[model samples]
Target: MFCLPVAGIGASAYRGWPTRTGDIEICPIQLPGRENRFRAPAHTSMDAFVKDAADALQPYLDKPFGFFGHCFGARLSYGLSVELAARGGPLPQRIFASSCLAPHRGGYFGGGRSGPFTPETTDEEYMEELRHGCELRGEPTPPDELLGLSIQVLRADIALTCGYRPPGPGGTPLNVTTISWTGDTHMRPEEMDEWSAYGDVHQVLLTGDDFTHRSAPADLLQVIADGLPERTGVLTP
Candidate 1:
């Protein structure tokens, strides 16, 4: 199984979760341009970024596995599911997508997924948007090794976020079970409901202090493990 991190943080955020949850093996997928990979080239478009993640995990697709993504990571997971389907491969047994609404649920803010990054946006202005965005819900700040990389990644991600236009009010159509986190300022409740139209729905509402990532990683994993399709079985799908 794969546990993807939120935007600024890497797979290191899942340190609170078990390496193996019941029958599922947990492997947190790392985003490029963060952690030890700070020096790698960054991706500016959501499509390209998700493709990179799918490519990185292609070697491990020998069997069915669960996938989890948070915030921007969640956005990529949805796209990855679509790509995997297009390839006629074994899809995720379940997809835990948190902190982000289904792609088309909320109307596109910036431009929908069509154009390139915007210019005339200074780095400082971009950083302020991140600060406000992060403050809206709990998300991790960059560590020293990743501080600069985080800024770069967020800027690139914002370009995608600004340009993201969804398929419609309908959610993705992957067969995997879909999990969503509520109380996220980034994604509203009605938007979350749109996710149910996609597949099996499991909503985890994190109100109060738990609304943010720092206060909710453990709870997040628990939700994923407990809500998994099956703890033990033949593992055939």
Candidate 2:
């Protein structure tokens, strides 16, 4: 399976994941402009980004593979699944999404016309937004230099998410099972239920914040293990 990180982050965001999840090789997708790919320009468009990701993943598609993404990465993973199917590439056996609303749900940051944060948004305001969302934990906030860099990456990420326009009605639903792993403390049951429209839904609600992927990696991995289909060839240790 390939792991995708949330916004303003890269593959390192999934550093806590075990080397392998069951029989699945835990390959984390490192988006550009962060971590090792820091020099690469951040993708500005989701469609173009997903296409590039799909092309880059072609060689790895030899075996049964799947995707796991959180927050901003969730939609990207979904788009990749759709794009692969459309491009006659290997389709995923399953899609694991966390802490994100379904595309049709459509209300972003209170469903505003313009997103809560934009490229022009002041650095101070962006930091405040992060704090208001309770996303900044740990003592000793990042220094201004690092924080400034993070804010730039974050703005680019926000642009991708905010610019995303969900597909219209009557779209083709994926055949693969979709596991919606949401933190019960953060997402409503009803809101998560909307994922069923995408495919066979196996909802896993756990105790944590929106940061379940980070704070409770083990519990989240267990959920994935339990939901792995027999055909997925997940080796139990």
Candidate 3:
């Protein structure tokens, strides 16, 4: 499975995940402007990002694979799948969307808010918000220098999310598994039912807080293992 990180963070977030979870191999995608890709400019357009990501993933598309994304990453997973299908490229067998509302819900942030912050938002405000978010996730805030860089990447990511427009009415549907954490305050499990519009959504509720996914618990792995096939096979062109 390809693991996409949450907003404002890097692929390193999944560093704790075992290299292989059951029959699934964990592959974490590294978006630009964060971690090792810090020098690369962050993408502010969903279409552009998806196109580039599809191109970059060509070699790995030979075998059956799936996507696992949390929060903003969830949106990217869905977008990539749609884009690949449009291009007649290989598609994922399943999509694991955790802690995110369906695209048609029409809101970047929870509670139908268009966006939480804008380019006009002051650095101090962004810092405070980031700190608060870390607190909520039970993690320590990054140092000032790192936080400053994170803010830049986050701003670009937020712009990408805000600018995205979901498909109208009936969009293409795929096999998807929507995951919700019992303690997730950001996106409640009950609010994610709209995902059914996108595909055969199998709703899964895990017992943990929002950041629990970072730990890659047994239950979460088991859920993922259950959704995937026991053997990997090549995708027919």
Best by lDDT: 3
Against the true structure, candidate 2 reaches a TM-score of 0.84
Candidate 3, 1-237: lDDT as tens digits:
889888889999998798887667888899999999999999998998999999989888988898999989999998898899899968888899998888865546643464446656788988998888788867888898988999898889878877888683357778889999998776788888888877678999999988899989999999888888744853322
lDDT of 3: 0.84
With a 3 Å backbone cut-off (N, CA, C), the pairs that clash in candidate 3 are: none
Q: How many residue pairs clash in each candidate?
A: 10, 0, 0
lDDT of each residue in 1-237, candidate 2, tens digit only: 788888887887777777786676677888888878888999877887888998888877777777787767777887788788788867877777876677665534314535446556899988876655444444366566767777888888877777777673346466333334443444555665677777666776666666657654677777766655544443221
Q: Give Cα-based local distance difference scores for all models.
A: 0.60, 0.70, 0.84
Model 1: clashing residue pairs? 110-162, 111-162, 112-163, 112-164, 112-165, 113-163, 113-164, 113-165, 138-212, 138-213
Candidate 3 lDDT for residue 43:
94
Candidate 2 local Cα displacement, residue 170, angstroms? 4.2
TM-score of each: 0.72, 0.84, 0.91
- Model 2's alpha-carbon lDDT is 0.70
Which sequence of candidate numbers ranks them by TM-score, best first?
3, 2, 1
Clashes of 3: 0
Overlapping backbone residue pairs in candidate 2 total 0
Q: Write down the TM-score for model 1.
A: 0.72
Instruction: Give the TM-score (vs. native) of candidate 3.
Output: 0.91
> RMSD, each candidate, Å?
5.2, 3.7, 2.8
Residue-level lDDT of model 1, residues 1-237, one tens digit each, is 677666556677777666665577778776677777767766667677667777777777776677777656666677777777767765776777665566664323222432212344566665665566556555664344444556677666666655555554344455433444454444554545556767766666655332345444666657666766554432322
